[model samples]
Target: MEQWKKNLVVLWFGQFLVMAGMTMIIPFLSLYLQFDLGLTDQHEIGIWAGIIFAGNFVTSFIFQPIWGRLADRYGRKMMLLRSGFGMAVVMALMGFATTPWHLLLLRMLNGTISGFNPASIALISSTTPKNRMGFAMGTIQSGGIAGTILGPFIGGLLADTIGFRPIFYLTGAFLFAASLLALFIVKEPFDRAKAAAREQVSVLQGFRQLSGIRELTALFAVTFLIQFAMMSPMTLIPLYVQELHGTTENLAFFAGFVGSVTGLSNLVASPLLGRLSDRIGAERVLGCALLGAALAFIPQALAGTVWQLLAARFLLGVFLGGLIPAVNALIRKYTPDGMESRAYSFNTSTLSLGNMIGPITGGALSGWIGIQGLFILSGVLLLANAAWVWQSLLRKRPVRSKA
Candidate 1:
């Protein structure tokens, strides 16, 4: 009934569509390069695929803060619409690309304009009641996770049925539709005059001001580490699954299951843990969840069977669910007024940086240390991150005396 609630509901769907559209290309990206683009060499196809896939994140990492600053000055809803519509056009053009270079450039362009998720988050964070912030962040996060879990599967199916190009058109159509939904339904109570009256700052100045705060700096690191740890083992999961299963038959199915199971559990746990964080404290939820996530990775490193690894990943998801929402809640609590969008944008930039670096580092390390050892290394990094959270956030809280 409330305007903020309406915005949250609309933006949840917006997040879902944005993530789903972005990920839909994953299923057939290499296939598109090899078949449609006429790349005959397998190695060339692989290289092109990697480049095109990372291009979006590469540009996204650089541009998120710029967009965030604009959102703070103009309006978050406008930024959201700009991204949604801009990405819609770029995604549709990918369906028409005649070369790998064309696709790569389009992907980069899409990433350059991509700010729908962060803008939605900033808008919701600004409008939602402080007490309900955890729940709102968690609920919105579940939307993206849900989209991530389903996008590839749906893309694969649609690619087979309607063919690859049609899937791109379909994704673009869905994204456009989502944008229209927000345009009509989502109401942002942005005080443009008030925002205009505030002292204007460059994006670099904004970044420096936010990063100067110790708590925000620590929170930013936590964001990066969480993404890095999760994404590092991602590209190597299939090899580990193969080792555990000891067979090639059904390998794709098993690997897909392992890849998606974490998101499935994460989707279920985010809202629940978010509510718990609201009742107790986001700091407590974050600390305990980090420790739980760190411990969960140990079993993955030790598992001798694919089933064991699956169970471990599912457990890890339960804890992973708490990290982002709690972090977002804390960011809102600590950020100075009128700069919330910039703060969230900076955090998103760190998130994109982690996403870009994680797979590369994971792929590199897995060869030297092996996948199992890589798992152990990831766990150790998370444990160290947990310690950082304690020192920087949890331990510094002023104790309240009981009446």
Candidate 2:
């Protein structure tokens, strides 16, 4: 009913649709590369699929800060519209791809244009009340988590029923529809004068500004570590599931269930932990979640059965749910008022950086140290991260009180 609450509800759905659209191709990407694109060899399909997926992140990482600067200058709503519409068009063109190069180029372009999530986060952070910011962010996060959890399933169905190419068409259309809702419904209280004043600060100046804010600098590290910890064990999950469950009837279903359970629990827990953060403070919630996730990983590493691992993952999800929202809320709390968009964008880049590093480290080490070792390494990384957060927040206490 409230204005900020209204923004949350609309943007929640928009984030959901956008995330769903992006991930909808994950299930059948290799299939499309093989059948439709005529890549006959298994190794060739794997190589092209990795290239297509990694190409997006490579461009996305490079382009995010640029988009952040533009969002700060032009208004975050405009950035959101740019990403939404641009991505929609790019996605639709993928439906017509006749070669691997076509899909690869389109995906890279999509990444270069992709700032929808960060733009939405920046806009919502600026619009929401400071007290309720954690709650709002958590709720929005749940939408994306839910979408990520379900998109592959939906894409699989769409693939089965209508085939591969039409899946892209449907995803593109859904994206356009979500953007339409955002265009008409989501409102931001923009000030041209403020934007003009902000334009005076150059990009290097902005980075220097973040460096001067000790808490902001530390929080950025926390962001990267949180993502690294979450992603490190991800690539080994299917293998772990099979090891625990055995190759039985419906093995793929079990693998999918274990993969999704963490996100499902995240969907259930984010709003609750977010509200908790609002009451007790985001920093406290963040430290606790980091520690909780670390401990949860130990049980996961020790699990002898699929059900045990699933339970541990669900617990891990419950803690992991609290992290990004809390971190975002803290960023909003500490960042200079006019620089919120760029700050969040920088945070998103840290996320992308972690995405790149985590899986590589996990995969490389899994062979030498083994799959269980990756989980242990992740827990150690997270525990160290939790300590860093504790010290960082402690240092901020005196400065915050003086302010």
Candidate 3:
């Protein structure tokens, strides 16, 4: 294989293993609280379960920017190593948890310590040539999509058949395995002088730097909106499938399938979109893609059958496929070279904030307004963000527009 292809594969595998560990906990946690831990009341269950999961995002939001800065000052490899070791420990300890509080603490620790994906992405971005960056990042992102597909399915199956404890053990083991992959298989082109001279910026400096970049600011805004809109889909899709009369035996499989298909779609679309973005510009692709996402949700809202919903999701996936790689590429296009990791860290933190807000908001809307309302709201928000980004980045088309 060529060097680009070789690096892409390693990065994808590394991300797949790391994210597999993280994603395993998401679908199973609420069930665990309700059945395994004996939290029976719906309100108590929601509150406690929310706490256990949200704690990680809260801690991660606070720490990601810091870690990104650290990655910039040190090296991407060092940051990846730290993330792998820290997450492995956290996942292992989760297996030993005895209560909700124990799980919450473990999760918080996981968030504070976890920064591997952003680091690995930064490394991939820095190591790959500019022309190939988008495809490279897209290929790696496909790994995350794969993990999302597999994690919940495996988590549910392992929990039901083998046991929940094994889920954690498996997660920890996978993360350790990813750590080794990062340590040995992944290679970086040397820039010893730049690496040695890199200076760590304060968290405030990192934040300030990200804010100052025009394209990055726009990207961040879209990040926030996309996250807020997608929260409902993430939290409620499985429930909706159940409402449509899907069987429990197929629940995990379907959920994983939805996620995996999205990744698969991205596998098909990302490289194409990335290449197109390089030709026509990232902003144009972003605007068109966001609009496509907004339109795709219409079918989702009106769907009367499982197949309809699946088709909608797959279409949504195709449109949304190139988003992350585009964001990273745009960030790279505009951000100072040495600050790549810090920029990604800020991006990750913004994403964490979205994760914190998306599910809760989606749950609330699903309960109060109805699922249709969730889709409507998500579509409207995305469309609005798409418009704003277009006006800011593409409409005016200033001579020096960073995008």
lDDT score, residue 230, model 2? 70
Q: In model 1, which regions exceed 4 Å deviation?
A: 398-403
> How far does residue 115 in candidate 2 sit from its true spot (Å)?
0.7
lDDT of residue 175 for candidate 3: 85
Task: Name the candidate that leads on TM-score.
Answer: 1
Give candidate 2 misplaced runs (Cα > 4 Å).
Answer: 395-403
lDDT of each: 0.90, 0.86, 0.79
Which residue pairs in model 3 clash with each other?
A: none
RMSD of each: 2.4, 1.6, 3.1
**Candidate 1 per-residue C-alpha lDDT over 1-403 given as tens digits, one digit per residue, 9 for 90 to 100:** 9988998899989888888887888999989888798999999998999999899999999999999999999999999999999998888988999999999999999999999999999989888997898999999999999888888888888988998888889889889999999999988889999999999999999998988877788889888988898899998899889999999999999999999999999999999999999999999999999999989989999998999999999999999999999988888888888888888999999999999899999988887887778778878888998998899788889343110
- Give me the overall lDDT of model 1: 0.90
TM-score of 3: 0.88
- Residue 35 of model 2, lDDT score: 87
Candidate with top lDDT is: 1
TM-scores of all candidate predictions against the true structure: 0.97, 0.96, 0.88
Residues 1-403 of candidate 3: C-alpha lDDT, one tens digit per residue = 6665666777687788776777777667887777677787889988887788788889989999888887877778888899998898889888888778888889999999989889888888878877777677667777877776677667877878877777888788878887887788777674767866766567897788679876788888777776777776676777777776457878865765654566567667877787787777777788889899888888888988778878888888888776777877877777777888888888888888888888878877777777778888889988888877787777876565232
Give the Å error, residue 278, model 2: 1.1
Residue range 1-403, candidate 2, lDDT tens digits: 8777777888888888888877788899999998899999999898898789778877888888788888888899999999999998999999999999999999999999999999999999889997888888899999999888888889888999999999888888888888888899889998968788754577668878876876777788877887787777787888888888887767788888988999999999999999999999888899899899889989988999999999998999999899878988888788876787888888888888888888888878888888788888888888887888888885456345111
